[model samples]
Target: MVPVNPDVTRFLHDGRLLAMPRRWEHRRVVARWLAHATLPDLLEPLGERELTDRLSELAADPVGARRAMVDLGAVHRTRDGAEYWRTELTEYDELVPDDAVEDATTSEGLHRTLHLDGRRIESVATFYDELDRVFMAGEDRRLRPGLDALDDLLRGGFGAAHGADRVTVVWHAFDRSRDALGFAATREHYLAMLADPRFDAALFRGRLADLEAGRGPTYAELVLEVFADHPGVELLLR
Candidate 1:
């Protein structure tokens, strides 16, 4: 079931209507609540244009709502701005202040995770916090610095140091971002890609560039480089 505060929903018409509330406090609550309401529809990757169009369909001010999603860490986009994913916050039920989340997301403690490989990710909790800032609720050119950090980390391998369970957590978050931003991948294809012996961050970025340049490979083409084989890949585009 979708989670939304009943009282807060009323301010925004049960999440069906949009109102830019006059009060800062009201705006904050409603925007967060709307982010919650946006979950079900965001089950797949969407480009920047696509996401905004969807948001515009419902809200009077689509830009504000879209920005709210990023600002609140409710959604994450790839560093290239080519894809986005909804984050599954472990503590989604908790009542965290918006200010607190903002403060936490921007705090610097991850400078050390860079330039290491064949080692367990030293700071798991810290990694995800920063990861969300860049992926789930990030915006502006502000994303580049974090993206560079991510590339350096991924150059070794995503969740590589962590193994399947840990990879699964961050990967699931990343996978969801793909749903919103990257091309579509079925559960089978996605899991296969995750379980594959190797994942190339460089290759991943190349595909992103292709996506942005209008000459990108289809998801089927992506599966080839990312995995040994994905059956019915041919049927994916038809």
Candidate 2:
């Protein structure tokens, strides 16, 4: 299947970018498309001059394009800026389903099940709402969605007297959820954190930098990592 560039063709004519996008979100999408179009192979690193020359084909300002790509977390370069490559991202375009079989029992039937509907999780805000419905059901403690909060919840503090000995989280329509929570969403999530004084500005700033440089994990991956850290938590992506 031919991969489609997301809403960026409007800025192009005869395969050349007409102009830079004014909106930051539009700029991020355009820059991300530029990085993918120019650097299809993540393993192959291009020299500074070579990369600029390739980017020059798309935009008048190759240097600016490079900067935008770096700023959007589409590409990365060495400290000396001698070499450049595309930042790695989870490909939602083609999702290969997970084949791991669930364990049938959890030691004398202490198994509990939770349902996470990915279709309802369109944004970080909605993601939290769904979490509240599933994990905080019948509990008065409402959680503000954040990684730390999520981590604490995974430790079984959501009105639970004790953490479940074994539990399985069946994430329905997992691909759709992953698509909704992809690069753009994760970038914006961190960007919001960076602006909010309530969050750890320093931590979020570093995370944003890493994300823009493609050195950081996506929000979904971060959540998975949190779940992985706690034993007896099984996630089944469907």
Candidate 3:
């Protein structure tokens, strides 16, 4: 078992550090870093005072820490030069789904399951509508698009009405014409998709043969990835 670092633990658990700072940039940086750094990672190398000291040194240098935290949204400076916790700057929003059932008398009960395969592709609009219905009904549904073109077609949106508990999006090469060329093209396409404004989607690339061979993360990981990638459709992860 790896040891934990006490300074990082104290840094995270201490109420003084957790308080929100006034600067929006600082808060954003803190939120972003906190969101990405898990408790275990912070605790790794348990009882390693040397490692902890390095972290402490970084924390002590407010300017350096602020820059590192910038990626996570924590960019503030105090009189003493120490950083305080802040909120993330992600652009999450709330919009009522078009298919939400209004009144109990006319409301359809929740639609829980949606299976996407080649056959279901024809009713794409209805599929999206049903996603809205399920989300409004307070259920999280994982969405996985096969290609960048497909993800673009859906406008980089889809998820539960509420918010995501866990979500991820993965892109794998399943039916490319040539193995080597297909792999490179698939990765490039996925990177381009990530940059698309209409497609604020995450990308996960895996071996096409491995996926086709049925050796990969469990079904749950796949579902969670779909949920994580589509914050607009994050309610599905719940």
Candidate 2 lDDT over residue span 19-52, tens digit each: 7799988887787778776777532467889999
- Taking the tens digit of each residue's C-alpha lDDT, what string does model 1 give over 95-124? 222221211111111111111111221233
lDDT accuracy of residue 47 in candidate 3: 26
TM-score of 2: 0.53
Cα misplacement distance, residue 15 of candidate 1 (Å): 5.1
Off by over 4 Å in 2: 1-107, 160-163
- What is the alpha-carbon lDDT for the whole of candidate 2? 0.71
Give the higher-lDDT candidate: 1 or 3. Answer: 1
The candidate that wins on lDDT is: 2
After the best TM-score superposition of candidate 1, give how far the Cα of residue 34 lies from its true spot, in angstroms. Answer: 2.7
What is the lDDT, from 0 to 100, of the residue 64 in candidate 2?
88
RMSD per model, one decimal: 18.4, 16.8, 16.8
lDDT of 1 at 98: 28
